[model samples]
Target: MSALANAPFYVTTSGGYLLVLAIILPAVAVLAMLLVPPRHVARIAFAVMAAGLAVALVIVAELVGTGMALAYVVGGWQPPLGLALRADGLSAAMLAMTAVVICATGLFARFHQCLEPETQDGRAATTFWPLLMAIWSALNAIFVGEDLFTLYVALELLTFAAVPLVCLDGRAETIAAALRYLMFALLGSLLYLLGAALLYGVFGALDIHSLSRLDGGAPAVTVALGLMIAGLLAKAALFPLHLWLPPAHAGAPAAASAVLSALVIKAPVFLILRLVLDVAPSSAGPLAGQIFIGQILIGQILAVLGASSILFCSVMAFRQQRLKLMIAYSTVAQIGYLFIVFPLAAGTETLPAWGTIAWTGGALQLVSHALAKAAMFMAAGAVAEAFGHDRISDLGGFGRILPISALAFGLAGLSLMGLPPSGGFIAKCLLLTAAVTGGHPWLAATILAGGLLAGGYVFRIVDRALATPAVELVARRPIPRRLEAVALVLALAAVGVGFVPLQPFGFLQLGRPAVSAMVAP
Candidate 1:
């Protein structure tokens, strides 16, 4: 029997099985599609995306309704020996975020997601759905896995699935980019796996809770934590470790680019958070590894990197001649926001410590960015589709030709820029307040600076699109009403999250650690 089975919410707690099903169902859908001839691949992929999205919605609704953690036991076995999946507030939030983005990406890909749209049956097109499904599955596995080894497997699965999505077009440059991604990802995986091995050897456990229960006495704990964090940082594409991301993400098909940019790098980040806050003992994390290296200290470092990424990449984003490359740089900048919570929430003296405010902020940032970025990328895809190129300057008067896409892009841009009544604005505001309360001036500065830089980049697009051009853009094909509407809805959703109150919310607190658990009075 599952540990959570006795909880009043177990009937709805299938969040765990729902997680696994979310991951595997798409893979199964892909396999079934493979059996069909080429012409049917797009139809099959769309059908699967439709159903997969519904499953995601069910899980989200249950999470919202129960206001509790959800779980599922694989093989009816519990943790340590039996694999399990669990979703807390943060995880459920992420799941819902991923579902929305993936759904948009699928619709956007229909414009040219296939390998050869004209060929009734072709290799690239058919391979697209399978790869997309694989990526989604890998993402779900990463989110809900309760054990270190399980999460590591999920990480690798995500990497493998994502690498192929980069090179779907079979171009030599894209192939090379994918290979670079594969290699760097492998190095990161090795580091993380090594740490997991060390921890298992020392504690005889891979479950996060069990590992947390171990006395922080072993040298193995320190070394393992270091290795694991370093690995996740690489995959997260943080600062110097981000060598592969720009090319790989930019070169992928637009639909793939949206997913890669919006979601793929996030799995490792979630794992890193788990390793620090869940596995590390409260008294074991310090700068030198003396106490539970409070996630806040590392959070500061993350904030600095985030700030630098925001400032530096915004400039890089501005310089990009290709629309997708610019958006890719914007992605790197947005990711910086996710890392700011560490320093802002590191106080060990308070119940819930500094975790709650920063955690909720980071989750909101992730969700908002996913929705906004996906919409923007899809809009960019629409631009490229209409004009046959993504050169920002050459995108003259695209707003006139593709009004809906331009409108969607602008709304998404509004959220990314942290404008009022948008999720991005609320997320940043919360992080800023947390920084101020926590006395983290550097994090506070980064948050403000990032918003400014984001505004600059967003305005650049809006300005260009709104310009009365010497010549106006014309669509290569009729822009579909359904696709346009979906993109618009997603952009609006990012704005909707802003409606959530600015205070530290109880919803975010629901399953978080109690006041006294991590923070000693």
Candidate 2:
């Protein structure tokens, strides 16, 4: 049977058309926005975000209702010839995250323009709407693509859609940042394509499901895996190769910054996870063992980098003159948390495989970060809008000036700090437990240190935001309730994640690969 025919799901059994709509609506919206006048941009973008979000929600509802993945075949052809899109639990989670972040960004940007056109045509606004739509479509595609070739196309589309968003304002610096982002991402893409080519050459097939089922591995496989992972790490901005991140992310407008930081960088990371867990060979044979060792070794290095980033970046954030810069650095620290899961849960399959706590924690971190970071960035954008600047020290107080925005910022900070009843806290707690149980002292230490640093940095902004503006900081445009409320909802969602059962969620394992072949010891 074709892979599409075997897909698992939750709601209605429909999968193909919904996936098509999820990808199409965004592209169509982008085109429509491009054709509309600037003044009509916000309305058009809002309508698109609403519709896109609805599509995303339906995908989850369907997935949950059927308790299986939904699948759609392109051109009515099966895999190995035609392409298929499958939304498994992981993809559904990612899809939901993308929808939330994109929707929030649209709402936040409704109050401002990146660079409105000079004419009545509103060309810039029109242009941005479509680009945003294009980006949403690309992200969804990346999450759902079942074939390596299909995924490669999705990654490229994501890159093309995203790079332009960085320079939407058309300023010289923003343009420079966008170019740097573009060049680095292209390099990453080259590496990924090289690996994909090698895979096709070896297996004569580029479908992940097919490859994993075939259990292919060897010198060529290792080499291809290395190239692909290296490429994705650079794309995801894992330290050392992360030279392009802060500038590109921090330089973008607030709404844009939120989406870029909270969502875009994650695409490559998601790909890496798929390669390692689903594609890479997992055995104790010299070659297979070597690959696992490499992953664990790299995971440890990443944990250290994450710890240092939290410490150093938090201090740097504290010293920042601009609020946006501080948040940008915080993005670095948050990225670190994603890596910690590597060392903690990525060992040999010994002693029940460190249980499922670590696995669940990592997924939690990814999702929660999406919600908290998106909300925080939107909140920060509101602060800048109200005060005309993000000067941390000078903006003595914003709580009095924009209560709702400040509150949203504070709530988001709570999650980032890993406080109780917040998803960040639940995520960290699970990771820490896993580290201790796995007997990884360093990983445990790093988790604690990261949390502490996060606390220090998050405090710096809240202090200023609540300080009661020295002279009653007046609102620039009366603190848009709609925008602030959007941020608030996101923050609440992050906190609610903490309420999810602490144990490993079966939903995450709906279609899990058999660990029998991969287990160590």
Candidate 3:
């Protein structure tokens, strides 16, 4: 159920067509790949990617210019029967960011997947184009979908598309990793379905806005919310359930890793946030110290899980000997920062959660991590491609061979370590401020501790890059400068995000349910 479920549905708005184009254009490109020869697949894919990027930008501009969410109801029918697609400020922002990362990954992959002289028309290259488009389509669908069941369908599409990308190389280990990912995803899907069914059975509606009108203290509603969130946590790979992540992400090609880390996992998290704050009753007058679910305060629970994720996974990231594995682990650690927003953004008597500094910080963290992690993965991919390995110990003086790639890595690291003039710095600082003001000393300490640990791991790689190795490293093949530029651009975006005003972002608050509207009489 959505927080905006009860709001009036507008059939089509001024910029509504852009949302349709954003979704269908990539899907059309995927179809085009099937008809064209393998050689032209990359061209069509790139063209679609470019158009998709434009559409996403237009959607953002429309939201900003109009200062209202763009909405499209199918065939003049509203939800509970017809599906609706709506893009709020947060959705628009995610759409733009997804387009940028996907485009960058497409460019980087072209060089990374340079056709073999004998196998220039290989299936591997052709398959990647369709898969990429499918992922782009699925991600857009999830962001804009206005109903719970529709989101479930989008999640399934995302999973199916993402699994193939994981094992594109068809190696034994990668195949195993992909299977593991699929298994966990299937379990998550089932749990989510069961929860959705429960919600429909209890409330007679699966629309988020519709669900928000229900009595939050009901037993069925509480159980359904719990089941739904638990399922999403599994999909999000939060801490204890993250076993399938490192292998699947690290085993994928660098381009795939960027998508998986940057966008795929975040979708589940976004849904969880919606479920907690929007669909679940927030003004239910604390039922036995818990309003989120019958027995548990979802915000505090999520914050504790977030803190545990940060402390445990940061150590795991520090101990990884391989570069890609370390980056994958870091992704897990960074996601924890997002969950911490739960407690920090849980509004007091005077303010709304969506208007809180912690909410803005969390959103910034999500976008910045996507940019930084994508850059780091691409840079590491280039290094692995050049040196034939990614062992950190053996990477001594490796920076001399690929200075641009190393520079990209360093810039991304700065964001990860929360250094000034980088998005991570501003995001973490805001979260820290909220924690201190909220009187949550432990969470404040977690923020600092995570940043310090991040610096330690980042320093390990920087040290290796600058040191002299006994055996000089050599490139197995030449890497194009354009490939290097792709990574640098994303890293620069991560840094540039820091320039945003250091306060609660008004843009993100657009389309949020009005406080008066959220409370049941």
Order the numbered candidates by TM-score, best leading.
3, 1, 2
Off by over 4 Å in 3: 1-7, 115-120, 282-296, 516-521
Candidate 1: residue 117 Cα off by (Å) = 5.0
**Candidate 3, 1-521: lDDT as tens digits:** 44344566556897888888888898899899999989999999889998999999989888878888998877877766777888988888889989999999998888777724455458876798899999999999989888899999999999999999999989999999999999989999888999999888876767775665555436766777788888888889898888999999999989999999999999999998888776775325445245644423777788888899899999999999999999999999999999999889886444667879998999999999999999999999999988889999999998898888889999999999899889999999999999999899999999999999999999999889888989988888888888888999999999999988653298887777666754534
Query: Which RMSD does model 3 reach against the true structure?
Result: 2.3
CA lDDT of each candidate? 0.76, 0.76, 0.86
RMSD of each: 3.6, 3.6, 2.3
Candidate 2 deviant stretches above 4 angstroms: 1-13, 36-41, 113-121, 215-217, 282-288, 347-355, 468-472, 514-521
Evaluate model 1: give its lDDT: 0.76
lDDT of 1 at 393: 85
How many backbone clashes does every candidate have?
16, 18, 4
C-alpha TM-scores of all predictions: 0.91, 0.90, 0.95
